[model samples]
Each structure stands twice: as C-alpha cells, then as structure tokens.
Target chain A: NAGVIQTPRHKVTGKGQEATLWCEPISGHSAVFWYRQTIVQGLEFLTYFRNQAPIDDSGMPKERFSAQMPNQSHSTLKIQSTQPQDSAVYLCASTISAEQFFGPGTRLTVL
Target chain B: AQSVTQPDARVTVSEGASLQLRCKYSYSGTPYLFWYVQYQRQGLQLLLKYYSGDPVVQGVNGFEAEFSKSDSSFHLRKASVHWSDSAVYFCAASRTGGYKVVFGSGTRLLVSP
Candidate 1:
C-alpha cells in the first residue's frame, strides 16, 4: 500500500492568493484527518471526515479554511485569500482503526 | 480534555548509550497512547502504541514504550542508541474509542557518534 498520498509536496503562494491541498487516503480506510504544523504552534487539528462525511471541524479557522471529502479515496483542504500566517506543513492522515497513518504532507509557504 | 506533555524539547546521547524519552499524559480514564517519530521533512511514523493488553509495547527499530497508569506517563526507551535514531519524537493520546487525538509538542533526539 502507498499509505496516504498528498499532492504538491511544496507550495508557494503570495499573500491574498488561494491554495488548495489534496490527499488520497489508503484503500478501504474510513477516516481521514487534516492537521497543520508550524514552528511556533506545532501541530493543530484542522478537520476530519469519516466515511466521506465530515465528522469534526472545530479546529478549522472558519473564515478562509475549508475542507471537503467528496469521495472515499480523496479529500481536499482549501484556503481562500491565504495569508502569511497560513504558512505551515499541512498533514493528511488515514485510519481504519485507532492508529493513523500519515502522508508526506504539503508544505505551504505564503509570502 | 485529553492532553500529552513531552517535557524534554531536545536530548543528546551517545550512539551506544541507553536512552529514554519522557512523556506525561492527562486524561480522566484509560487513554490510548502512542509514540511517533518524525524524520526531517517527513511525515510522522508510528513508533509504538498502548491501548490495553500490555503495559509494555514494542515497535520498529528496536523501540519500546512502557505505560504507567499510576504515574500517568508513557516513556519510550531504547536499549542501545543508533545515530539513525536521531529524530523528533511525539507523544499523543486520545479518548478510548474516539478519533480526536491530542499530540505533545515533541522531543528531539540527537544521537551522537
């Protein structure tokens, strides 16, 4: 298994630009999660979906951050009018049970 | 709320020396604990996990962790360190049967030769 796959290992966006990150979970996995990691804040939970349905998004920033899991295999996180503070490593993980397997992650840099 | 604390931000040890990374957790009931290792610029990899059965669990690269209910800690240990073991270690916890996971800031290990 490829575990989980995240597109655009690195991305650079100017302030006020929009960015979208993608994730492909492992086959048959029912849960997908998104997290953001920064040097100052560490890792913060962004959102999650179970069986292609959003279960929790309490950690999302609300205004510019949005996530979608339209199908079982993939999920997307979009940041509209991205700001410099949004620069961080965006991690995607998939899980069948309690243990979660993570992908390489997308490093988003907003300048 | 469930939380985890990795007190040591960084630790240095010789290649052949024994090593221990401390982790303390705060949870009301039995918690599912995990230790994950992250290589530079890479995703986090599960080192070991403790759910119920055994207090001591083994993981990849000869790593292991012991769960202590009384002390509310799950400390990772290695018999002999290797330079390859140099990485950031994270301790995480979640409510039993819950999906939300809380992670510690992480402890960086530097194994010197």
Candidate 2:
C-alpha cells in the first residue's frame, strides 16, 4: 500500500498567486485529513473528509483556503491568492478507522 | 476545548541508552491518546495509541507509552535508543469517536554516538 501520495513535494508561488496541493489516499480508506505544519504553529488541522464528503473544516482560514474530495481516492487543497504566510508543509493523511497514515507532504513556499 | 503540552523542546540521549519523552493533556472526557514520530523531512507516523484497558501500550520500533489519567499524561519511552530514533515526537489526543485530533508541540529527540 503506497500509504498516501501527495503531489509536488515542493512548490513555489509568488504572492497573490494560486497554489493547489494534491493528495491520493490509500485504497479503500474512507477518511482523509489535511494539516499545516510550521515551526511556530506545529501541526494545525485544516479540514477533513469522510467517505468523499467534507465533515469538518473549522480550522480552515475560511477566506482563501478551500478543500475538496472529488472521489474516494483523491483530495485537493486549493489556496486562492496565496500570501507569504501560507508557506508551510501541507500534510495529508488517510485512515480506515482511527490510525491515520500520513503522506510525505508538500512544502508550499509563497514569496 | 482540548489541548496537549510537550514540555521539552529538545532532548539528547546517548546511543543504546534509555529514553523518555514527556507529554501532558487536558480534556474532561475519556481521552484517546496517541504518540507519533516525524523523521526529518517526513510526515508524522503513529508510534502507539491508548484507548482503554492497560495504561501501558506498545508500539512499533520498540517504542512504548504509559498513560496516567490521574496525571493526565501519556509519556513515550524506549529501552534502548538508536541513531535512527532521532526525530520529533508528537503527542496527540481526541475525544472518543471524534474527528478532531489535537496535537502538542513536538519534542525533538537527538541520539548521539
């Protein structure tokens, strides 16, 4: 099981540009989660999906951050008009039950 | 609100020596505790989890954690440390059947030869 797969291990975008991170979860896993990691904030929950539907997104920034799970296998996090503060490692995790298996994460850099 | 605290920002240990990392949690309900490790440049990986029954739970790679409800603590330990064990350890907690998993500020472990 490839665990979870995240695209573009690294990404660089100018301020006000758009950045979209991709994640492909393990097969048959019904739950997917997204988190942002930084030196100051540690791991911050962004959003989550259960069975291809968004369950909770209380941690999302609400203005520019959005997430979607179009199918059981994949999900995406899109940031519109990215700012410098958006730079961080975006991590994706998938779980069949409670134990979450994480992907290598995408490092997003907004300059 | 739920929260977790990892008091130590960094810990250094000699190779083959025993190791321990401290964690404290705050929650009113029955807690679901977990310990996860992050290798450099990698995402976090689960080490162990404690839900009920025995307070002492074993994990992969010779890691174990003991949960103390009285103290609200779940600390990770290893009998013998290896260089590969150098990484950041994170303590997390959640309400039973809840989707929100709160994480603590990680403790960075460094194993020296």
Candidate 3:
C-alpha cells in the first residue's frame, strides 16, 4: 500500500489567498484525519471523517477552515483567505483500525 | 477535554546510552494510548500502543512503553540508542467512542555519536 498520499509537499500563499490541501487515503480504509503542526501550538487535530462522512470538526476554525470527503478514497481541506497564522505542516492520515498511517505532510506557508 | 503532555521539549543522549521520554495524559475514561516518532520531513509513525492487559507494551525497533494508570502516564523507553533514532516523539490518546486523537506537544530526541 502507498499509505496515505498528500499533494504539494510545500505550498506558498499570500495573505488573504486561499489554500487547499489534498489527501488520498489507503484503499479500503474508512477513516481519514487531518492535523496541523506548528512550533507554538504543537500538533492540533483539525477534523476527521469516517466512512466518507464528517464525524467531528470541533477543532476546526468555524469561519475559515473546511474539510470534505465526498468519496472513500480521498478528502480535501480548504482554508479560505489564508492568514500568516495558518502556516504550518498539514498532515493527513488514514486507517482501518486504531493504527493510522500518515502521509508526508504538506507544508503551508502564508506570507 | 482530553490532553497529552510530554514534559521534555528536547532530550539529548549519547549513542549506545539508554533513553527515556516522559508522557502524561488526562482523560475522563480509560483511553487508548500511543507513542509515535516523526522523522525529519516525514509523517509520524506509530511506535507502540496501549489498550489493556499488560501495562508494558513492546513495539518496533526495540521500542517499548510502560503504561501507569496510577501515575496517569505512558513513558517511552529504549535500552540502547542509535544515531538513526533521533526524532521527535509524540504521546497521543483516543477515546473509545470517537476517532478524535489528541496529541502531546512532542519531545525532540537527539542521539549524539
């Protein structure tokens, strides 16, 4: 298996621009997770999907962050009007059970 | 609210020396505990996990963790270290009823030759 696949290993966006991160999960895995990592905040859970349905997004910023998993194989995390504070490593993981396999994250940089 | 805490922000050890990374957790229920290592520019990889049964669990690459409910801690240990073992370690937990996994701030380990 390829584990999980995330697109654009690095992203650069100007302030007020938008950033969309992509993730392709492992085949047959029913769960997907998104996390953000920054030096100050450490690692924070952003959102998650189970069986192609959003289960919980309490960690997400209600105004600007959004996630969608329209199908089983892939999911997307979109940030509208990206701000400098949004710069961080966006990680994605997929799992069939308790053990989740992660992809090399996309490093988002907002200037 | 659930949280994981790794007290040490950074740890340095000589190669061949023993290693220990501390972790403490808070949760309303008996949660599933895990230790993950993140290599440079790579995603976090699971080293070990604790559910029930034995308090001490063995993991890949000779890594093991002992869970102490009394202390509310799950600490990762390695008998001997190598240069390749340098990475950031994260302590995490998940509730049984949900899939939201909470993570610690992580402890960076540096193995010096």
Highest lDDT: give the candidate number. 1
Worst window of 10 by summed lDDT in candidate 3 chain B? B94-103
Better of 1 and 3 by lDDT: 1
Residues A1-111, model 3: lDDT tens digits: 778999989999999999999999999998999999988988888999999999989889999999999899789999999999999999999987777789999999999
What local lDDT does model 3 show for residue A86? 97
Question: TM-score for chain A of every candidate model?
Answer: 0.99, 0.99, 0.98
| Model 1 per-residue lDDT at B67 | 96
User: Which lDDT tens digits does candidate 3 get at residues B1-113?
Assistant: 78899999999999999999999999987889999999999999999999889999999999999999889999999999999999999999888655668889999999999
Of 1 and 3, the candidate ranking higher by TM-score: 1
What C-alpha lDDT do the candidate models reach, one value each? 0.95, 0.94, 0.93
In model 3, pairs of residues that clash are none
Q: Which is the leading candidate under DockQ?
A: 1
Model 2 Cα displacement at B84 (Å)?
A: 1.2
Runs off by more than 4 Å, candidate 3: none
Model 1 clashing-pair count = 0
* TM-score for each model: 0.98, 0.96, 0.96
Model 1 Cα lDDT, one tens digit per residue, B27-77 = 999899999999999999999999998899999999999999999999999
Q: Find the candidate with the highest TM-score and give its number.
A: 1
Lowest summed lDDT window (length 10), candidate 2 chain A: A93-102
DockQ for all models, in order? Answer: 0.75, 0.68, 0.65
Model 1 chain A worst lDDT window (10 residues): A92-101
